[model samples]
Target: MVLAHAEHSGPRVLNIGEVLAQLSDDFPTMTASKIRFLEEKGLITPNRTPAGYRQYSENDVERLRFVLSLQRDQYLPLKVIKDYLDAIDRGERPENLPPGVKVSPRIVSDEFAAEMTGRVRALTEEQLRTESGASVPLLQSLLSFGLIQHSNGRFDEHALQVAKACVQLESHGLEPRHLRPFQAAAEREFGLVERAVSPLSSRRDAASQARAAEAAREISELCLTLHRALVQDRIARMDS
Candidate 1:
């Protein structure tokens, strides 16, 4: 069975050193760079100190545990992992287990959810453009390259964030064409997710559809988290 856990409150936040000491045994390959990568990819948002150092809370550590466990045991790509996380963030807890994967139950107290309640806000494309200051052509370019997408003819909060980032990247001379690799990579990840969810999704029963959706959402978030960690490590090497 795949090991999974949930975040709970803690008395104090932990620094990188403490985080490393705590996680080193379970996730042998976990490095500071990967943690930073998760931060960068918005998977785990750690608070920054006055000195610009990261301070990860207990919540952050549990998130890392879930991420590492999924990558090591499930061999899921980052995209799927991310989708899973996103679903949770959106308050959708999916059936996590699929064929060949058995996830243990995650335990969390009522207090656990107190700090993390609310609806995930979604926005229209026009609203996204208005708020993000993204130009029409830039939005078009992102769509053309498959970087940012419209869901149900509207952009979700995640899509808005991606569009905003793409706008910033454009200022640095990385155009949407340069981001096509990311799109291709996402498609490949989607392919893997489809294979995993198709069997359940194809069943005629009504419950099967819900299960498939849940499975798809969870795996997708898991893959995204994994992707961020792997990419963070590679990017970190450049400074080393």
Candidate 2:
């Protein structure tokens, strides 16, 4: 469900002029021709009425805001902006998003977007145990089994998440040792992502670096989706 907010079924009530009226205060130079140009470039697809008039939804207006903000603030080229929008269309958060760029909640889950934009406070060992409801022995077992690690005496959001998952699994009779395969599988998947993005990563340009990061993020999300589907399929087979 985290990635399910990409589609919009809202009514497209704003005409092109209405959309321009809403945005022109912020993007003073925004014009009908510019909006049409973005559509021509495949960056946005506004709905069309039977009379051949363009109809823009609230989501469409927010999307235009995202695109224009990137252009005006970051000076990013349309191509790069298109890549970011494409990733959003696929329900992905683009990596290393420029600070303060607003994304539409309709296009991405707020929680997923916050993970990219917000910083998680590092948890102390006691804090981790309290927050995750993990016992000391279980935390020790997780660290011993290489399922989680603390860095510089601090556990991060990831460690907390893993600890919480392990606690839940423990209740189901699965222990830290039983979850080692997941760590290994994660490493293997990350390796595949690294290799896939190597070409873009090797480039020195800012745009290329951004592309590589986005590609890595997108690939990782896809890998997780595949893994989840496979696991679900296996579990479903138990009933058959």
Task: Choose the strongest candidate by lDDT.
Answer: 2
Alpha-carbon shift of residue 125 in model 1 (angstroms): 6.0
lDDT of 1 by residue, 1-240 (tens): 111123434577799988988899998788888888877776676777799877777767777777677677666556566666665555444244334432222322332243223333457778989998899899998888777777677787667778889889999999999988887888899999999999988895544654677677678999999999999999999899
Q: For model 2, how does the per-residue alpha-carbon lDDT over 88-122 read when each residue is reduced to its tens digit? A: 76645565566566566655556656644564356
Candidate of highest TM-score: 2
| Candidate 2, position 238, lDDT | 100
| lDDT over C-alpha atoms for residue 7 of model 2 | 47
lDDT of 1 at 27: 82
Which ten-residue region of model 1 has the weakest summed lDDT? 102-111
Which pairs of residues collide in candidate 2? Answer: none
